[model samples]
Target chain A: MSATADAAGPGAVRFALEGRITAGTAAPIWKSATDTLVSHPNRPIVVDASKLEYVDDVGIALLFDLTRRERPPEAKVEIRDLAPNLATLIGAYDPKKFVPPAPERAHVGIIEQIGRATERQIEYAQQMLGFLGNCFKAMGLALTRRGVLRWGEVLDVATEAGANAVPIVLLIGFLMGVIIAFEIGLVAQQFGAVIFVVNGVGVAMLRELGPLMTAIVFAGRTGAAFAAQIGTQKVNEEVNAIHTFGLDPVHFLVLPRLVAATLVLPVLAVFADVIGLFGGALVMVGFDIGFVQFYYQLLGAVSMTDFLLGLAKAATFGFALAAIGCQRGLATGAGATSVGLSATSAVVTGIVVIVVIDGIFTVLTS
Target chain B: MTEPSSGTTQMSAVSVRGLRMGYGSRVLLDDASFDVARGEIMVILGGSGCGKSSLMKHMIGLYQPMAGDILIDGESIVQARGEAKAALQRKMGVMYQSGALFGSLNVLENVRFPLDQFTDLSLEQKNLTARMLLEQVEMAYAEGLMPGELSGGMLKRAGIARAMALGADILMLDEPSAGLDPITAANLDRTILSLRENLGFTFVVVTHELQSIFNIADRAIMLDPVSRSIIARGKPSELRDHATDARVRQFFNRQPDAALEQAA
Candidate 1:
């Protein structure tokens, strides 16, 4: 394909377009044609389309750019021998349109970058607080009403996010328990107080490690899955479909996932605590601390208040993680990359929220 | 054209019988029945939220109908299971409204995916075939581009190539003209016409564009958002000329509800 520009008259130029005017062949022809048109400002250009066999949108855009007139809306480009059907396309487009936007600055200072980042974080935190308010309001409304919440979807989500996650959670907890007891037992051996290792393991498993570890695992696994699922639905217009049917997405989609996470996390943490203690006790045997002595020591080291506090932290962590995941998902923009971004943001945000909330709980309890 | 008392079982390529679709208590389509004769180009028309795309989704087996059956090649898709369901899927190919191409795959690979999954064709053969299909849609130039890089019209064209990769007898397209210019949209219509004439492909297209309707549809059915049923069905010309229902005539004439109210 060749595009040739020749002077038709003193103030007019004739451009002959040949062969395919598609993305594959439009580049050099585009550059030279634009260069020609831009140099000869305000002069009318004649585009000869008689030789053109095929043209796609890229070709259309090229023609528009070539013939594009500046501001006051003067039509400068005329086509000779364009097929009647192709004429309809040109008719739909304004010759004055398609001006290239001014290029943005490529660089910003380090201080400005830091300032912008800080501003964005502040905005994000503000939005998250608003979302929390909305969630609480919706929950209150649902409890007061009959048909607001979908218990079925909650059950389904709970099974997937909780029941299916048991094996992995238990495995991680067991490994953590064994590692902690082994390390502490070694230290206690030097002090000739190996039985005291049971107290350390017991308190850590119940009051700190169990809920914290389970929340972290949930952030990585269930939180990411929740974000991806909802983000894809948003991308596909499924969430919009729910909206068009006069349903609030927060009430319909988010609530079920939130309820599921909150309900299951405490139960999961309890399992983690029990299995972790079991693993720690087995490790205590290696230090010549018998199961009976270990059990009595664990009973004394951790009280019901400690156990309840851990479960409360687990529940709050679950709520925060699910809310963060759903918020990130609902905030997803267009394209496949946005869905991946939302999932990544969800896991990162969920873990951070879990840790921050855990710190608050620890301070309040202490 | 002589209408048949004896249509569907032996005569039509697709027969959707008494198909009911709804989400929860909100019914979108009810008792919707239609037949598409072999090699026919049928257009489903509706206003926004009238479930035109949803109807097409049901036909593609993306959603199960609330009631009734859709038969493709005289086989019931609603009741099919396992290999039977898989076989039914092989006969029908779909292009979604979003042109849902796999983000990770380039144009050529996306088109070749069906061939790879369903056929024992060699890699070279699959590549050549995919290239040929892309050429048919005027997208062979973009074989190396990822789905994300292509423009909306290009993405639609690539999706069409991928849908045709299976050489399925029935091709369903949702809003094929949505992102295209008049010239490109006209070209697409011509492509559909050419494909139908040459290969005897049956096309079930969901589009609201009247120009496209006139250009390509052999038969047209209008779904009414208020009525939740097919309000009009005939040649697009016939419906445009002589439809008696106010909503059908209003849609045909592109009349606003306010204008109708003023006239009354």
Candidate 2:
């Protein structure tokens, strides 16, 4: 055993074994080794079981028992310098007993820690896909069992994600239309194509601005709300309570919000389109553009394809906001800061998903 | 109702074989094996982070074991399939360390949860059953109150009531009396014993309270926190008399044991 310790290098603790370790003598050695590891936490511990030692099954059993116990993550435990016979005996007792020590500087340096955190973030993101798949499965099961999703919960989300958001979407839609029409109409009048301003504004509002504006509103309003609600529940263990009750949390919690958002966003976008058109027409009235001609040209420019496309975009945007919101909510930790962080991240994620999906749709259909 | 198979008549309520569990590189439990007979109330005693809660979670299917299998009525939870897993889950109840009652749900609604999930009972029937369970826990008047409205003891009572709602054969409690006053906790201990005597339901409880273990547990499993594994398992008195593991001795002695002396 002494010769074996010498071979394992200087990073080992050598102990002198005086006599044959019977059933009774093994307990104290085991205690000594485990106590050393526990007391000197945050440092590598190498137990050198070298020197005149003859160990029985009891000694081997005690050593194996210590190996199975939990150690602090930062602590490194290693068995060094075992006699060949003793090593084989320990190996046969538990072949999977080998745990190499943690590398030095596992937690040292801020930059390296940040890099590790980013890797963890990426790993978590990959795991999130599996989580989403489970949620979708749970959603399907819930729908099959319940026959229909809860409209009451949907209404609550719509109120927060849509109705309450209407004022802002409307306000922004109106200002954007007025600004675009005033600028575009001035340029078009020079070419005697003032009526084309109606066409330009109408098509843009129906096909793009309406959906984009409503999605942005949802990202800020519903997205943040989702993060806050779920985050608070996560901290409070309401989510775990749901699980303990034999209900899948994904089905019970995620589906209702998903269904609600899907139904509400398209409706909100339609409202935005109307407000935007009216804003453009209001500005056109100042330029002496007849209401009758504006309505005629607007109808011509905004086709069925335009309306359908906007509606599709709305649906996609709704799911994005809901998915991002719900994901952020589920990932929340048990703190106020964690909840706030999730909420902020949810809104940011919602907007990013909305823009990326919109761009994908535009590229595909165009 | 899904009837229990006659083939499983010989099965224990929960049987763990060569079980191992850990978080990442740090092993919390290794080669731990035990069995709990039907209608037996078994309590697990351990200091903080000794894998008591983790073991309970594995037995109830909340966690997948890294090695070995936990059998719930002879079917391995680690190997159980879709409906089988759900069936296993339906047969057991868990009361978490915090009681884990839903803040969004009132006491009555929380109790009704298991009934709502697995049972075909109507809403009215569910409500009636929830009320009866609350009454048993001496909280009939508190049914309309939300979790926040209830005190700590009241919340734990409500959680226990919910755990019993499904009539599950195996009931797992993680620190059932944690954070309650002595009187309230003692009352809970009495309630547990009474339920075990009357209902013939099996219980696997993980608690740090010596009083609760002595009063309620028919058999006990004690985990050594420093080792992160079970150092002792037997009847409470047997452990008190015969635990040779220094950690186990320290645990029972409640003062410094051999390990502390060695460290000093």
Candidate 3:
């Protein structure tokens, strides 16, 4: 192939091409044309291809590059006297070299930012409520039909989420009791009323800390687990597969977790309360208070109302945690990162809901 | 192998010799051998769980064979280490069954990933290169879309673009036609054929789809689950017509092989 360039005018150049412009010969011609265009910037270039024999896709791409180059204003390109077949081929190729860049987003004001966040929150709350309603319906369906609930799966989930959680709950509850008693006893010693440490520990453990701590642990452990497990199932299309088989995932997967958490958490919380009292007893012994005296003071300080209220809080927190977890899981997006994000969101939302509900319970009781 | 006039010998782009592959003690394939010539499409054909994908994974160094070696362009990838291994790895690209595109990245960014990791190209050049590759696969329109936003067919096209990003001499694809409709699958086969003709890259495709096999395969090896070894090796039409093995004949004709069922 031969390419001959001639000056059309002061601001224009024309090239005459001949012979085949296949992949082999297109590169050098392309390089020379690009070099010539660079040297003569801001000039109209025309290719008179009447003598040209043939041009392939790569050859068309080279010609298209002339029009697509980043040049100063006043630079233009025109192809003339081209064969109709080559023109048709070039049209079909339609090399896109001048796609516009995406527009930069402007910053939003604080009010708009807050408004958008609130909108998202409302949407999330609506979805969660819908999920909860479906769970209740599924629960009712399971109750009406025998063997629909999968008692084996329910027992498995209960064992995994509840029985398996005993050690961590006991450890955290014991540490929390020790920390509280030590801090409060130090202050009470200053007032010469160290015996009041037993009352404070008993009341706190029975009324607030036991349920709150147990709920937070459940949120971190069982709630995150539920999200990751269901999210993975969602990613792998296993959730959809279940639906195709006429099984409700809420009934099969979530109801077991919710029921298990509700049944198991209060028992775990009571265990935590007893363990926390022992922790308080240990602190009281360190402060020279007898175990008998501490036990009597604890009995005098805690009442049936406080114990029942704490158990109620525990059960409610359990339900909220499991619900949020299952909701986050069912709402999982595609891919692995979404699974991780679901687990994280489950834990975060579960804790937030737990704390908010705990505050409401406290207000109602007060 | 005879040396060709193109400055390189007519050696296989990939060679698996006496390959025994499996997990732990369960042998999936035993004493399997194959050669994939340069610039030709080689298809690994089998029914479900017949270890076609396992063999592809072993050849790609994702899984080590229990015995034997894999050679890429005369270099032993099975025994290669460190920089040598990385060099061999850079010579080949893999497209997984699910596309396996990074979910966080847009189509353009996912295509640019291998180029970014291996090349010193400028940002603009990288973006241009990615766009060009996407255009080749007809995915340029969806460059800004996330992997999750793409349909199954579109995702596979994007994956092929990404696999071609590094300009690898060899490309391995697992189930390129899986989950796609018949027309889309045929179009994908056309894309593979055109790409091979234009770019001259060797392809090692693992697929059970009969139409895809007949359309794109220059040569194919069918694995038999019963024997746990290659049962047929030839062109698709040849295997479909003249294969003496009843199992291989059943496979190409899409019939339920009695032997396979009995083995199961």
Which candidate tops DockQ? Answer: 3
DockQ of each: 0.06, 0.02, 0.24
Worst lDDT 10-window in candidate 2 chain A: A1-10
Candidate 2 lands at a TM-score of: 0.48
Tens digits of lDDT, candidate 2, A1-366: 222122223443333434444333444555555556566555555555544355433344444544444656544556566565455434543224223221243456998889989998798688678777876786677667765466677777777777777788888888878888999999998999888899889888888888998899888888899889988998789999998998776776778888778878999899888888899999999878888989988887878999989999999888778878888899886546678889999988788878889899899989
- The TM-scores of chain A alone, one per candidate, are 0.74, 0.66, 0.76
Tell me the tens digit of each residue's lDDT in model 3 across B147-261. Answer: 8789988999899889877667689999999999988788789888876765567999999999899999999999988899999999999999999887887888777657557
Evaluate model 3 with DockQ and give the value: 0.24
| lDDT per residue (tens digit) for residues B118-176 in model 1 | 65545544565566567668887788888867788888888888887776768999999
Give per-residue CA lDDT, model 2, range B80-130, as digits (tens): 979889888878878887678876677888998876766554454456556
Each prediction's TM-score versus the true structure: 0.56, 0.48, 0.85
* Pairwise DockQ winner, candidates 1 and 2: 1
Clashing pairs in 2: A1-A50, A2-A51
Order by DockQ, highest first: 3, 1, 2
Candidate 3 C-alpha error for residue A34, in Å? 9.2
